[model samples]
Target chain A: MDFLIFQIPILMVQASMDGILLGILFALIAYGMALQWGVMNIINIAQGELVILGGYIAYFMYMAGIHPAFGVIVSPIVMYFVGWGLYKTIIFRVVDRDLFISILATFGISILTQQLMNFVFGSDVVVAQSNFGTTMLFNSMVTLPNSKIFAAVVSVIFAMLLVLYMRRSKLGRAIRATAQNARAAKILGVDTESVYAATFGINAALCGVAGALIAITFTLHPYVGLPYTVRSFMIVIIAGLGNLPAVALSGMGLGVFEEFSDYILGTEFRIAAVFLLLVLILVYRRFKLARKREYLK
Target chain B: MDLFKKIFSIFAAISFFVSLALPAQAKVEGDTIILGAAVSLTGKYSTNGEHTQNGYNMAVQRINDMGGVTVGGKSYKFDIIYYDDESDSGRAAQLAERLIKQDGVQYMLGPYSSGLTKAMAPVTEENQIPMVEANGASRSLFTKGYKYLFAVLSAANQYLEVAIDLAVEKNGGNPVNIAMAFEQDAFSQDVRIGVVEAAERTGSTIIIDDKLPKELNDMAATLAKVKATKPDVLVVSGHSKGALTAIRQISEMKVDIPMLAMTHCDASKLAKQHGKNSEYALCAAQWHKTLSYSDSFFGDGQQFDKDFNDMFGYAPPYQAAESAAALLVYKAAFERANSFDKEKVRDALAQTDMQTFYGNIKFNDTGQNIAKPMVLFQVRCEGDVCANRVVAPTKWASHELVHPIPSWSTR
Candidate 1:
């Protein structure tokens, strides 16, 4: 009934800043999906749960009189092992099987993790506060939380460090080789099976970092993992695997799009808008691919 | 095309699950009183569903202990036939029909939420069965003139009315600017309308009114908007999650507002997590342990709170209190009618007048309990200890009202 954005133009600035920062965190999670998809060739639907579990680890630290900001460092270490264990138990079995099997397997894992978190975390909406304070811009018309800015900066640093790690590290080279050709890498003594586990572990660690950031910047609940999973999957599909800049850009684009949609379409439709955009993007991509096929014909 | 196929199949599969209808097959023949309920036993509403069920179960146990309801010198033990609605309104409505038409259940108690009650009410009304509910508080439920629909709790719209009155009174007659973030669900939407009306009545301006995301997971965006606008008070009317998100984000973002009020503040469990920050956050409550309202069945309200805490290991929220009150209403109606006939009990319930451990039960023409006054409660933090204290309606005030809460910078 009322359009507050039109009345308050400053909210536009507020919304965009919030959206960009939030999107950076989202992109960080999506980057993990891209890494695993590129190297392991499997879509992990439990990405969101890994992020939430990562958040819980940080939340536990905060509860134990440790600063939540340190969760960015701690959560990944724990989640990496979790991811490795998962790979050893189930993900490894799904690898080289039909892509659909991986999706279904990961979906089952997602449900299992969600329920277990619900039991462990008690299903309450919890946040690990960083309390970094706020930096007001434009005479305080634009209010930016330092936690979000901290999260965004942290996300960027992680992304850059990850890129550097992949380019320079020995495990990274082996993973890249496996992504290119698992059979050839295996023939060349690259240990493709171990590389798959490492890739999944790295992806989960990335989710862990993003989840820790989310706990600081946003709120976390056990059941909220699906949206993160969907968002990351959508981001990976749009940006394509192995494209860092595009992933970042498209993740921010998706974030900015969500904020604007929340403004234009209201919050009730926000998730709907995200899922709808995913559909629209996939359809548009399909149409373009079909056109290329027609040209070849 | 492949993507389209996948997406289409997902939608189709979802619709298939949603549209699957259940067939009703039940019958009844006995002298025992059959109180049917389509309650939420699982899903999102399960927690409150458990509370609602406990209230009814306790009431039945209490009434039966007194040798149950007597009709024309015949004593009949009350037996409730409850079907788990799975927290789905459609399923709740179907179960309500099963209770009424198939099982021949003449009386009903409503479900956990306003939406579920709305769904089940039409079925009860169509069958002309008297359905008394404890939890559904939406204002729209009564305005429909459904004769058979009765609610024991205060209406939804009135929930924020008393809180606003206190806010204006506390602000010392100065104009207040409020920013609100509410969930889009029926109950929260009703709270938004009440808040807006109350804000208008107090000459307060709604600087920014936003709805929380459906998941109610994040409110950083909304609170950022609040930080920018710097409203005198920020009102969050989302259910428990929405309120929790607001408190968490407000503290995380360090947005300093003068006052913060939320509908589900009482349920946020901030005492365990962030009591220091949660201090002075005002919430509207239907029942408090401080309330001395007494009824014969559950003793005084304090005893009711204690017994419920012992039974469920958590303090009974107003939903549980009102639920037990609904049964008390049924007990009074049955005695007043002095007959087991459906029409007789319906007439008696329409003319029901009594008090319970929850509060006074006197239904207005629309079958709404207008006598129950919503009390405003606040979190009182003392060092590490935090407790909810009634802070409004001076008569109900266990402590003085905390006004113009200190900004984050000041705290």
Candidate 2:
């Protein structure tokens, strides 16, 4: 109810721009979550930890005197193998089990990874200094950091590349086939096992990219990963599985909603607002599905 | 029957392990006096929690090495059993109960944050255990009539009001515009109260007062509002994360304000991390290395700083220093009481007034230290290296206060 956002009109433009750019990054992470959820049918509760692990890779690069921006390239490459190893070791066991089992297992992994990260990174809230400077728009009333612009651009490029690969690559077809029906794909001579592993790997790699971007754009800590996980989870729900364009749109929508809520409702309620929106979306979907069932009746 | 036996054996083993996992110690065993502590070893407050643990450990080691505390013709070494509170207030309260009821610990040490302290205070007070806490600076803690809870640091409200006074003094003693963002927590909210009081006294108009979330990182929206309505001074406090996030976003957005004041600059390592970008920021601290506070165990502030760095491989923040001072206060109380009795120790603590390497320890009836005034330090840079230089309380001013920090464009 703070009408300052309305009183000062340029703030709307600023909040919108900030939200969209921030949403693109969220979309990249959501795309990864959507992939694993659709392909392996296993919801990774450790998705945020993977993103944080990826960010630490870039932070280490920055610490080693290399530009953290290069981490977008390096982090995903490392994360792919980490994801593959994780699937082979832990995720595979929970893959065909109950959805609740996978959730609980990944939740355990999330806690373990957070502790391991705390031990490794010393529990400091850290950010990589990109020093790319700021980009002023609309007479500098709306200030945009160049690092954020770089992060948004990088996220878009990676998302596009991922889309193209999914459309064109052999593994991509196998993944889609497996995602459609694993038993059918296996019967049709597609190695659904390898497809599942690759899908998890690709999802982890996407999280890695998003992590590197976040390391530059926002602060990183061992415990901050859960919020990113929840945000991407909400975005995937809003967009649905395998819908790239919708994921992008919903990510931006969430980002804008968050920024506007931050400005109007104040910062303390920002996370609460996000959670409330998630609850609303869930209730709205439930009502819509219930209505459809009633119409069928 | 064999399968049933196997299941019974597994349960038996688990129960055995659970029984063994329960601590087997009293308040005093042989010549060692055990103190119970629940610190944040793994969560949001882990970094500061580590500092608190280290501070307690360092003091314990130094005191033991220096011939332990002599009480009633017997010398006793200090030992602490620590539980990880996980930075949750609910968990901290539970752990405090476990320490007192199950572990049989009669003496208590405070946790890292004020929220956790507030949570544990009731349990300690009910048990009549004297807890010397170095952190937990929320003003609300002092208002509560808890006889057992003792804080070695000043109340949270005193942390940043001096910065506001300094801003007005610099502004030709006229009431100035103030913008403040405080974390929604016990300590930071108390600091907000202090700033609000200062503003009210000076007839300053508050342009923006934002309450930051606990798990804060990004503050771009708040900065945007600050830019839209420029204020004379911006005050921020959230432990370490809030300080780090403010400097990062403020530098990124290049939001220009005449004066910027914050808390936890040292704890966050702002000067070392942000370098030139963090320059001219006024930070309120309980103690600085340049301070002249001295004692025999750690000598002076500079000596403590060096020894702490040598021991821990990083400069000790005020959190660690104050934590160490709490241990010193405990040792002094033990010596003065001249007995292992909890009542005598409690009375000794209540009647205590002493000096430590960190600061002068003199707790008023509210268990808040009133003797040591809070210090204000500015992050000053020479070349590319920046460090905190004491700038206020003219008695310890190592460097002059730089007013109206140069705008982002000039920098």
Candidate 3:
């Protein structure tokens, strides 16, 4: 009995730890998706591919004898230009179109990027070698890979900075105004097209940074990006669009929940748990909104 | 004038008939034999599939250059007709069916990963075409009593069993307080089950058995728990990503203990990824570049490795050997059968008692290899070169096996 009691907490600790570390990565990637969907109202299905592009950029940089830390530094800038170009040439024409068309266009972009990656990389698993395994934070037991911890910390810092910029900066304010009412922003002499392009660029850069961080822990193959895209979509939908903090929180929550499910039910059931949680959250939201409507009446 | 027109028309008709029959005769008369390959070339298992394809291609090239396979008083040249399944199992099944039915191929080589191989199994069985699996290790594949299927590589259970033996007996380490960290997949699950059963058999206690999610990126916390449990031995069953993550996390936590790994974790690439921190990591493999085999009609692995490196600009990975061995086994079976008939070839495969690049190979009634050699290797850094030294079978060990890993503080 004593042994059994001791084992339970050990298992819980394991589950929580796995969840927290993975949750940070999930939030970072999903937050970028939310930014594009909530502000631009464009469901960029190519967000995951942007992450893959970032991973390749870092991998190639590392191969060229650059330190992984410096590689992370340069990857976002490269991705920013890519995003900016994509918006100017492709996204601008489709911005005011029907939602389905936007989805289809971005989806096509995602497939094209995946195939392009395969053509270039030839589907071998690539990793960025670094001193990621050296840092042990919690008394030599709770280890944090330098790269993963760095990625999470950077992601959090970036998220906070973005929020502050949106609240305080003039350009940020203009972008928000454009998101809220593009016609009014245009009347106020704000260049809505430039704002949209810049915002899309920022979103793409964030995905690129996330990819660089993910390469530290995961294998970089062409197809691994698609599943992450699906998970990001799930996080954005469940947390509600534009709630960046909630997106981060729910992403962490989902990661923790998955870890726990992996411990208790088994790994095979983890996906099933994610789907079940999504259904329950949707049902609860519907019930709460129905009650609010009745109260107003 | 009517008789002259009739004669001209008949002559033209005869020429047309001969032209139509020429292509059929050309196809039948050629000394070329076609081997169909349904492998994942562009998706998740592409790495494994590509390595296997490279090995098979190299072997075929060498055989053809040496004047092809001599059988039934004639030499037959070979060509591989391959299609990429894109890592989709359904597509693999569909491709297998097409290769047999439409392409009219008598024999087939892998869809490398176990899931894809299992998906192709029924199709091959239904069509009664023999398929030599390259790198699939799932035990359930042969347990189904499918006669058409033949496995050249060691099964997952065999590899795990060897690892367990090394950990408990040879290393002189207590197997009590064992923990398993594995990827949640068919291949990893088999290894996990094997660990549990082996632990029970050896009177060892399992402190924790955890399945990390597929494509999991962060493993710091899991490593902490594993440290806390303070297991005598840690067993990791995963591919490249999971293996690297576990190794890096273990090193970060600085928990020094004997660790046993599946074949996926036992590669030079993982060592390169982890650098110097990969030392003392152990895994069971069907073939290692260092292991020796008696020279025979089939090629030697050491010579093959040298030739492969000279041709491909890098050392052939263990999967490459498995792939080449699979093809050699197919060639032997074809020669023994003395016919290209699919049923006759499968029968010959079932009764195979031969040697190949890896070592001596024979299959039992269940289509599983019997008496297959397995090597246990330890990662060691010599000067600037890092390589996995063969440390099992006692005869192959360059250095004595380090028993009961010293405490982290002492190290």
Candidate 4:
């Protein structure tokens, strides 16, 4: 009985470690989804496509004999310019439209981008191989992959920078103001249109970075983006819209919880655990908020 | 002048009537033989679909270059009419129907993934068109006993059994404990069942048999559970992504147990992806670059590798080898049938007992290739570079099998 009791913590620790690593990657991608959804309410289904585009760019760089780490750096800049161009032309016109129309437009854009990728890359699973070493802790019992650790560290640093920018910087404050009340921000002489475009550009650029990081840990294919888009949306909605920190926290928490469930219930039930977590979280939040409202009354 | 004008009008009216009736009266030409390909050229399974398409293209090119297929003492050039199913099963079935009925294509190939192939099977049976499947491996594809369909690759169970046999032998005379982590797809599930059944037959204990989601990225917790169970061997069954994720996590945890992997982990690319961490991982594959064969079909394996790399910019992965072998099988069937007729070609395929690139090719009554050889490879780290060298089934092994798995206590 004591041995079984001790095993539970060991399983939880394993689950949390898995969760934290996966969660950081999810948070990085989900940040982009949140930006697109919270600001324009566009629900860019192509958010995942941008990640795939970023991954392909990094993969090509690696194939060209560039180091994986250096390729990761170069991908975001190229993707940034691509995102900027996309915003200036295509996404700009759809900013003021109804949410559903914007979603449909982005959906079309996703299909177009996916097809274009298929034509060019031919749908092979390409990976960016890293030369990094692994670190073992707990007397060689718990091992951590260097690439995943690097990706997680980068995700945290980027998330922190984003939060700082949103809190301190003038452009960031203006973007926030616009998200909260666009007409009011416009009355204050803030160019909301430019803010919107910049937000989309920033959102896509983040997705590119996430894509680059993901390439280090996983294989890339043209249609791999759709699942990422679905997972990112789930993270954004579950974390609550427009709350970047909460999004990151929730992403990590979800990851850890998923790992725990996988440990306890087995990998067969891993996906089932995620859906169950989503339901539980939503129900708990609703109940707590309802109780709070009653107390306030 | 008026008489001439009247004659011209009458001639013009008659010519117009003839032109309209020509399309209705024109017979379908014997110069062309249509072969339909329904592959997922644009969706989730497009990676394999693209490779299959390349193989199909190469085969068609080679066949046409040899003066095409001879039917009834006359030559008919093969023309492939392909539709992109986008990896959707319903779309694959619809496209299969279109290829058979509208396009009038007799012989067909693929819908790539097993799910897509299963969806299109009813349509093929309804139309009675013979389909030479390039990449569907579900047991049901053969179990239904469809005479019109022929599988070129070995089933998932056969391949998994090869790995299990090798693992059991390598683990000395001890009754080994096994843990299985499989993707929730039909292919992986079949592999899982095969591993468990084989282990049971050998009196080995299966401590863990877990079914994971196809889209899962991390497997650390699952790896930890396997470790907790303390299984001597872990069997991972999934496609490339799931396999890579599981291997990475297992290696990261520094668990020093041998992993018997399915075909997804058989690629050299996985070794390249995980670098030194992939060391000691074992996987079963249909073809290895080191295998010795006759010079007639593949020349030398080394020369084949060089040529493939020169042509495709990268070395041919195992899937490419299988794809190449599949084409050879198709070519042999066509030549033996001595006709471009779909039913005749299928009959020739069903009766195939010939030598090809992968190995001696033979198909059973259910259309599954019975003579496909399975070879095992182990990932080894030498200094800085990691290599996947063939090390099992002693006859086909290019390297010696290393038993007991490298210990976590040592490195």
Candidate 2 on B1-411: residue-level lDDT in tens?
Answer: 999999999999998776556544447889999999999998878999999999999999999999999998899999999999999999999999989877878899999988899999999999888999988988888888889888999888999999999999999999999999998977889899999999999999998989988766778899999999999999999877788889988998999999999998988889988899999999999999899989999999899889999999988888899999998999999999998788899989988899888888888898888889999999999999999999998899999998898989899
Docking class of 2: medium
**Candidate topping DockQ:** 2
Residue lDDT tens for model 4, A1-297:
013215545555555666798899889889878976888778889989999898888778788888766655677777777777887888888888898888888899899898899888876566787756578666545667788888898888877888899889998999999999899999999999888887887887788788888777776878778878888888987988888788989899878777666666667776787888788878998999999999999
Runs in model 1 lying further than 4 Å from the true structure = A1-16, A61-74, A85-105, A130-146, A186-193, A260-297, B1-34, B81-83, B97-106, B126-128, B143-145, B169-176, B199-204
Best by TM-score: 2
| Full candidate order by lDDT, most accurate first | 2, 1, 3, 4
* Model 2 C-alpha lDDT per residue in residues A16-110, reported as the tens digit of each score: 99999999999999999998899988888899999999999999999999999999999999999999989899998889999999999999989
Can you give the TM-score per candidate against the true fold? 0.85, 0.94, 0.88, 0.86
Model 3 chain A lDDT-worst window of ten: A1-10
Model 4 CA lDDT for position A176: 92
Clash pairs for candidate 1? B137-B156
DockQ of 4: 0.50
Q: List the residue pairs that clash in candidate 3.
A: none
lDDT of each candidate versus the true structure:
0.83, 0.91, 0.76, 0.75
DockQ-based class of model 1: acceptable
Using TM-score as the measure, name the better of candidate 1 and candidate 3.
Answer: 3
Query: Candidate 2 regions off by >4 Å?
Result: A290-297, B1-31, B88-91
Which consecutive 10 residues in model 2 chain B have the weakest lDDT in total?
Answer: B17-26
Cα shift from native, residue A72, model 3 (Å): 3.5
